[model samples]
Target chain A: MNIAEALKRTFPMKDLSQGKAASIFASVKSKMPAFVLKNNAPYRAVMTMDDYEILEWAHEYRLTHPGVVWAESLKWESEEDKDDHIALFNRLEATKNSGSLGGKELLDAVQKLAAQQ
Target chain B: MAEVDGRILDAVGRFAELSFLRMKPEALLADLQCLFELYGDSFEEVMDGVVKALKDIAQDRVTVSPMKYDLSQYSCYHFQSVVEQGQPADMRSLFKRAEDGTLEVEMIGNRFFPADIYTRATERIEYYLGDIGNMSE
Candidate 1:
């Protein structure tokens, strides 16, 4: 089902801009339900809402336990050569070519990441 | 995937450090490069992955005040009706399952968060990747 329909089934919502709908879809993807509306019908994609809620709780759970996690160690690659720059550029370009996942999920992802220690 | 994973961990470390101290997003764009790289293909997939991983890390160790958005507060904004509430703590395969004529829904309603939450979050990701404070260490 498209996002609008899916969302409609879950919540009493009004028509949303594609951008806003897309953003909400991203935010809720983490252990939350998101929907797309197509021809006024709900289509399902991604995980189940129950599962998404679990993930959301997990994020909340992590906030209380900050000592168990460990951080990774990365040495700065001091490579500023043209090739390295080009590779970074290539990666950026590749990602752009695909498209961006904006919305609340993106924002949630940001919040969850910030909570890490 | 190995290169990407490595870079992701590196950046995650930086984000962790920044988050530990509640820093801002002045350097968020730079710090988020690690997350941006890992989430290279689909923004949704990568973001979902980030949420999962961050939650995992938080649960494993360290303790901080959690930033929460009340699902009840912004109930009006939701489009879905019945969100599949999973195990209270497990986040492995949670998703929005569509039923006969309904779907689960929740709105973005975190009140404690600031307007620049995303920017701040990116900085946290950078701090974790950079291995700045590392309180556990």
Candidate 2:
């Protein structure tokens, strides 16, 4: 199949112009994450209801841990780079080609985080 | 996960130091992260428990005071839900497992926590937040 046919079968990837013209969330469905592209790169993601609620629960739980029960230390090269845990995790998952997570550092940080678990 | 673990402790320790009405989202975020680490695949079961616990506590937790601390002294709301485990006077940590292998949880509150315990309270709070309300339904 051609590129248009391939895109239709795999995902209804919409461009930013389309996102502006219509409700970006109009086609969202459970287990299907809708993508919005800008300059042919991922610009935004819209999740279905079930996915959104899971994120909500995770947000609630993270805000209350450890002092009730846990603690530990981290020694990371990029530790000083990003203090935000979400950003830090993103960095950990990033490839060096994307300018982060230089292999060893991510492994060390994940190991440190997984030690007690 | 120990780093996540300690960061969470730091947040709750700070939360315990503050008034209940001033609950910090920072601390709550830490608790959620630690929960993800602890339960992994079965985290959903625990979330259901949390929903149940919160629904019950959210009902009548306002007017009455906890027996452990006077409102004038300590602000940690160690309600009957936390203490009636009857397990120990000092189950100081947050999570415990029930006989059926389900996870049990506790809140962070104390009458006399040391000032030295929460030295990281001054750390910048940059946690990103989104609407907690389910938009699907």
Candidate 3:
């Protein structure tokens, strides 16, 4: 299920103290899920180790393949330049997300794009 | 008058010179705070010696001011030095006492260099003051 559904199923959206939140996480850690917690203010999510690992892996992937990640995406001059870069990025993202592209392939794709400009 | 350690004075002189030459204010303040922490129980005495030594070397170029903030948990001191001749190159250092009783110092102004230079300068300062064995990182 989605994060919202998972959170709703797990815990009530109420005034949860830091201590209560810790206890809740401790109780349900075996499921390795994510849940939302609030303390009379803004809501925050407490992610399980497995979910955190996934996020860490995604972060590492973005760092390794900056061109494919939107935040670390390339800067382009003109609208046409941006379009070209986005098109190259799309292809790179597809290959990357599919797990079909290795480090060498990713580098080759980036190098090929650079060579074009 | 209790004599200040000659070696400590020498290190301070070298540190001040290097700070002026390299133009790294943040590093200078950070190192200064670290230097104060090194002296531990002799903080007040060491600081008194430092002020005297800096005044002797820097002449009219240095100024020290006591500062107090409503939100701060401890006493604060401000130090400023005009290190360069032209274009008004000045660096200000603010030292606030931490809850643990050690002073925490931060730099103000002198924004020409990148952040990485400050980090490297900190490392260099630690090495320079290596004999004291209070170098953090």
Candidate 4:
């Protein structure tokens, strides 16, 4: 069932005062059960402990692995250095002829080379 | 004008400290509105009391100001707390005069959470308050 429909069946929105809301949230959390509120209200969703843990893990994973598009948008301290970084990447591509490497792999290789010098 | 009592002052001080430390926006706003309800007809007195109480507790760590907007018929109080080891945070309370001269107070902004947490908390508070408002209508 949809969240709204599920919530309506479990908790009625009309009787949800601020105090009642807090109490309901605490109860739902302690009970470790998923509940849908009669509305799409924020801070009112209560999920199972496992579901919450999964959500947190997914968030951490996204932060660590932000994908290629986000990694490409990262900035350097200086505009000149940013251009130098791009130039260095071009040189690396020519020298290694490693065009097949992904963006992160290429970045790692560039960083490794810079560390050596 | 009735002078604000010490008990009320103490309560306001505690509320400010909590708002500056760990209280979420919704809870903070709810507590602040409760204070207004408790103070009854002494809106200005309560505002002054809270400012003084915050200043006393914050001391050199913060600055408190009372501002009035003549065009909007609103009175606002602001406090910016400086963190010795991290980024500072600000809290603003606005009292808008209603049709019958009763002021409706709303406490908004962040005083403790980091930028990212504050942004997320604000979004949630806005959505929750919007839902509540809609339901009332």
Candidate 5:
């Protein structure tokens, strides 16, 4: 909501002449979230994928978890590329009681075996 | 003496091989609504006004909003989910994607699942064979 600082870099509508507009885009497309102003008011804004994704995820996480404050939940919105936990889930899911082990004993056995390795 | 259920483990392994993930328009649009609302009062006056100005293209994009983000992660809560497919259970390696993409769910994820069922299944298998050091760690 405190976007006053963000509004520092703005392109007035009349300034968007063809040649200048192309160069302006080239200058800010990568580092965007630039505002386009017309009649002294912002009309449209340009945003990069990174900026957009962060805002998108943050908004979604905020709405889904109402109790979580914006800044606190923003930390959890970054995308992680690893899936080791899921792999572990698979290995654990693939279990079947072929021998004598069935409940907690089985979990303990796996834990012990995992520990030794 | 409280142990795991053998049937549950068997079912999980068998079901892991299947893939049925679908997204409906309602759920998809709701996600977008949440995003637009980030601007608060400006959502309707400023943002929505832009859409109104470019209503044709904007409306079309809004219709296919679900396709915009081909999600890599899926935390299934319903029988037929839509954002993306649920993860496939393949315990072959330690770092491969869930059949393709990474799916990192929370400790309590999905309604159909009783949370971490895969872990239980793997434990049962290990308990039976009393082995798997080479495969899992």
Candidate 6:
């Protein structure tokens, strides 16, 4: 499939509507199929090396930004602390699904506590 | 001097055997990489040479082959199947028919039974009564 066709088929993003010819050119360069789906669900579309390189550059930029939690989350403060954090998240998820508490209240409490951290 | 050389060869052979028996997956990968770098060969070719080298170094060395996965084909043939064990039937003859392999089956009546007969009987019984063990639940 062509890039335009693939983008139309897969991506829900509205910004990709840059006319058909340009999309076809992009698809030709990426060597990725014009469409990609796994088990009838959209998986990933192929991209040109240039497009991938640009994405990699953007990823690096985000990783280097102090405000982004991607880098911070990868760091392990302590195994015990990591275990405790996971346990807390699991407990919160269980509480949310239990139907005994207000979801907005629980979420607001989590957001407030997370904001402090 | 020849006797001494033979003794040295024997010791070398023993050490090589021990080393081969003890080789791990990671070390084999490293060795294969080195062979590829030095020989300017394809990975499989390098891996084959490395296997030979390992065998020469020690007897019975284990090797882990690389795996390749490609996910591009969209129209490939696929299949689905499910195996289910049927509840025990109330009749021994149906069970015996199932055990004889005349039918694709389920267990019923303390014996094996073909699926068609079991299903027909089950539907008939369920139609008469709301369910098989209606009041039990």
Interface RMSD of each: 15.0, 15.7, 24.7, 24.6, 17.5, 31.4
> Candidate 4 chain A — worst ten consecutive residues by lDDT sum?
A66-75
For the predicted complex of model 5, DockQ is 0.02
Best-fitting candidate, scored by lDDT = 4
| Count of backbone clashes, every candidate in sequence | 68, 21, 0, 1, 13, 8
Off by over 4 Å in 1: A1-73, A81-117, B1-23, B52-137
Cα deviation of B66 in candidate 6 (Å)? 45
User: Fraction of the real A/B interface contacts present in each candidate?
Assistant: 0.00, 0.03, 0.00, 0.00, 0.03, 0.00
| Model 1 C-alpha lDDT per residue in residues A49-89, reported as the tens digit of each score | 77867767866644432221211112223433324333433
Off by over 4 Å in 2: A1-117, B1-22, B61-137
Q: Per-prediction DockQ, in order? A: 0.02, 0.02, 0.02, 0.01, 0.02, 0.01
Q: lDDT tens digits, residues A6-91, model 4?
A: 55436555446645766656655433543545555533556668778887887676444332212233233456544543443343
- The sequence of per-residue lDDT tens digits that candidate 2 reaches over residues B1-137 is 23555444433333333221222233344345645454556545444444433333434443323222111211122233133456332212222233543322222222122111122221111111122222222
- Candidate 5 structure quality by residue, lDDT tens digits, B1-137: 11223332332222222222111111112222332324344333332232222222222332211111112121222111112267332111111113433221211112212223334223322333344332232
Mind giving the per-residue lDDT tens digits that candidate 1 earns over B33-116?
443443355434444443443443334332223323321111121111112354122112111212331111111111112213
CA error at residue A104 for candidate 2, angstroms: 38
**Runs with alpha carbons beyond 4 Å of true place in candidate 5:** A1-8, A29-32, A70-117, B1-137
In TM-score terms, candidate 2 sits at: 0.24
Worst 10 residues of 1 chain B by lDDT: B72-81
User: Judged by lDDT relative to the true structure, which candidate is superior, 2 or 3?
Assistant: 3
lDDT of 5 by residue, A1-117 (tens): 246746666888777874567765665654556688988988987777877888789767644533233213223232231132223323433333222232344334433424322
DockQ score for candidate 4? 0.01
What TM-scores does chain A show, candidate by candidate in order? 0.23, 0.35, 0.39, 0.32, 0.47, 0.33
